[model samples]
Target: MTIHLAVDDSVAVLTLEHGRGNTLDTATCRELVLKLEEAADGAKAAVLTGSGDMFSAGVDLLSIDAGGAAYVREFLPALSDALLAVFGFPHPLVAAVNGHAIAGGMVLAAGCDHRVAAAGPGRVGVTELLVGVPFPLAATEILRCAYGTNPLAALMYSGATLTIDDALARGLVDEVAAPEEVLGRARELAARLGELPAEAFAHTKAQLRQPYHERIAENRASDDVHVDRMWRSAESLANVKSYVDRVLKR
Candidate 1:
């Protein structure tokens, strides 16, 4: 029930209400795809945010443990494809992060054209390396664009957690505002976008994203190799098991 679709005039808001952390998993991804399909047609702009204090815990670490690398290789991209649909949608997409965003959540937020966060929220960054799995090609491309030629490879490799202020400084978070103002700000920006000629904005956005999407298509060829390595890596196995153990410990 976390992925609720709220529409008002030309704006559509998809919110994550899943538990405290708002961690997205396979089911959430599927639900999101369905919601987006149903809600996106008449909307001028879309805003994505999480309920409560956490944007998302990223990928479901527990799912990885339950099925091993096979789960990641086979299913994670399917979920991301849903997110990518939003990323590549003709209209503007805004990320209104109400709380923390990590790993896959970071990628989802980054996928948007503009990213805004709550000033008092926890943090946002990719921590995939800490868990021993490589980030997906789409995420890599998004981060590379956000971080530039000097991508935050080390952050991904080291699983560093960036604060809201630091995320802004690092160019990861576009703007930070009070928690209550997050959605309003996104809607405000969406209005700005709506005022512009829709065709022009859509064309410009598509032109900017084409190169990145093409690059991911190129990576698709080698993606299988990345998948195979995880399936065989002891580190990947150990990381998944550890994450699973966290749930058990609770």
Candidate 2:
């Protein structure tokens, strides 16, 4: 399966295993939404994580470059939906960031109620500005909600990817654990959070994210067109190509 699903007691574990970096193409993005919906329906809490050396590298640039404008039109909306599903999930959700989480990956991790990063050499941050891509409306709100206005602005402007320690200090992650213990630590955190009265937790989460939801709902149509425009723009395409070239060289 492109997305692996399992249940450990009451916690649903969703592990991304599509390929190196666990990049989210249109298919994976859509699958993620379905998986989360299923988990939310059946599980008390959920843990989202990655296998091997990447939490995720973010959107699949190669896929976008290959598919062009038509694909961008399809993918951006799916991306927004996937992110909203995670950001607005009612029950306690934890991100077990095992490795690098760049751009959209960072946004996904940040959306969770609690973020736990593995100790060692993983880097995490929002680098969309560096890629010459703008955030979708829902994503912008998620970042604002996750990091507040100032820090989100700083992170985006600098396009800096930070070490686990820095990510912890910056509130990108709630805690840091040994590489071997990242998933375990996340599960522990999830279990504790799950102990809260279910209705109260769900109600409070809705209250916290309601503003973002409303904002996204208001601008989704315009945001969809704007993101598609950005994705197909010459500057953004060039930047994506350059990034792909650099990664290929390594």
Per-residue lDDT of candidate 1, residues 170-235 (tens digit): 888899999999989998887677677889998998888888889877776587467657744778
lDDT of model number 2: 0.88
What TM-score would you give candidate 2 relative to the actual structure?
0.97
Q: Which lDDT tens digits does candidate 2 get at residues 187-207?
A: 888888988999999999999
Model 2 scores worst on lDDT over the 10 consecutive residues at 241-250
Error of 2 at 138 (Å): 1.1
Off by over 4 Å in 1: 228-234, 246-250
Would you estimate the TM-scores of all the predictions? 0.91, 0.97
RMSD to true structure for each model, in Å: 2.1, 1.1
Off by over 4 Å in 2: none
For each candidate, the alpha-carbon lDDT, in order, equals: 0.77, 0.88
Residue 196 lDDT (model 1): 77
